[model samples]
Every structure is written in C-alpha cells, then in structure tokens.
Target: MASVLDAGPFFHGTVAALQAGDLLTAGYRSNYRPDIVMNHIYFTALVDGAGLAAELAAELVKGVAEPHVYEVEPTGPFENDPNVTDKKFPGNPTRSYRSVAPLRVVREIADWTRLTPEALQMWRERLSALSANPDARIIN
Candidate 1:
C-alpha cells in the first residue's frame, strides 16, 4: 500500500470554475510551466500558496479564467512535490504535494488573498524570465 504522506484539508488553486464534488486529475498543462502537461495534480496546505497558484494560473492564461481556490481531498496516495520541496524550497516549506489520483473539491475558498498590482507584475516578469531560460526546469 502507498504510505500516507499528509492528512490535509488540502487546497488546489486554479482558474477553472468547479463546484463541490468536482474531481481534479492530472494530464492537464501546468500553470507555471505551460509548455508541459503535468503528470500529477498539485495541492497545498497553505491557503495563500493556493491563492498564489490561482493568481499565476489565471494571469498566465491571459484572462481565460478568473482565480479560484478550492478546498480539496486527495482520493489516494500523494507525495511531496519535488519541484518546490527539497529542490526549491527546502524541507517542504511550501507544504506542497502531488498525486496521480484525482482530488475531490470540497468547496470554494472565497477569501484567499489576492495579489496586489505590483506583486502581480513582478510575477509576470519573473515567469517570462524563467520561461526564457532553457535551464529552468519543472521536475515533471
């Protein structure tokens, strides 16, 4: 059996409009690295982290969606996300995880913090620079 890594009132951030009981699965294109399709569905224990993700996702897609954070429950096993765990933010400070199984949406978190205009611009520039570099990797 797969070991339990976290007992979470986990949250997923995205631009996709979803309701309670909606399932989020892998195989969707990544919000950070738009060039690749992610094999695992990513979530975080932090509400702000999820909000950040939702912001990036919404902005990166260029108005295709509005930011939304949803409380979620993983259907099966999950593991720490290497991209942000030891590799980027050591010791999982981000409290981020990924799973191949579907995540069930519990409800929308309506009050997560949204980025200020300056912060949003900073991220926009940062993402542009990261995508420009061939060395920038998403441990996919």
Candidate 2:
C-alpha cells in the first residue's frame, strides 16, 4: 500500500506539489508489470484527495504525456523591425501556457471517483487475497 509521509520535511508549497506529483506518477508507473496487476487497495492508500488523486491516477494509466511549450508574445517593438515605426502595426503579443497534455489516463480516474466504502473494502480484500497467494486470480 502507498504511504503518505509527513509534509514537514519540505518547506515550500510549489516544491511539495512537484514532489508529490512526481512521486505519485512514478509510483503508479512502477507497479504495471507484465506479471502483476496492482490492486485498487494500494491505489486507495496513495490517493491524497478523491478528485485530484483520481485525476492523476487516470493519467498514469495512460502512460506519460508529451510536454508542451508555447512562445511568449513580444511586449515591445523590436529595434531592428521596420514595423516599429508603423503606427498601424499591432503588437504581436502572445503568452505561453503548458499542461500535462494528452490526458488519456483520465479513464482510469473514474474508478476512484466512483468508489464507495464497500468498493474500498472489496479492494482491500482483493489485495489481501493477492498478497496471500500471488498465483491466485482474485478478479476475473
């Protein structure tokens, strides 16, 4: 099962978020081996928040997404440009934004959101069964 360590070791909020996101993503990836399908019980433990964790989990299921980069628009006129003198010239202002693109993993996220207490118990039981006997198929 996943564990949540104390956040005190990290002082900054951004750092904590990055660390959390990275660790969560990496941990999820590590479990998808050919011989083993990780049970929901462990996933439940790793989830920090119902919505957020579900979203992140879904992405992990789809594998890593490509990074996106955008170009920032120029604020001031360029010194070498003849357009600088053109009063009619409109500034080509642009801003760059990025997101974890290609969120195909979102499909897996539904499992967490749809989970009820009973479902959680079932997951725990399945995990226990799997642990007790790796060769046993707990689910069809």
Number of clashing pairs per prediction, in order: 0, 2
lDDT of residue 94 for candidate 2: 15
Q: How much lDDT does each candidate structure score? A: 0.92, 0.26
- Candidate 1: which pairs clash? none
Residue 92 of model 2, lDDT score? 17
Task: Give each model a TM-score.
Answer: 0.94, 0.24
Q: Assess candidate 2 and give its lDDT.
A: 0.26
lDDT for each residue of candidate 2 in 1-140, tens digit (9 for 90 to 100): 43432221111001112311232211122121224442211211122233332333333444343111111111212121121113223441111111122111211221223446576457556545655775643221
> Which digits, one per residue and each the tens of the lDDT, describe model 1 over residues 29-95?
8888888999999999999999999999998777677999999999988899999887876698889
- Top lDDT model: 1
Off by over 4 Å in 1: 1-3
Residue 23 CA error for candidate 2 (Å)?
9.0
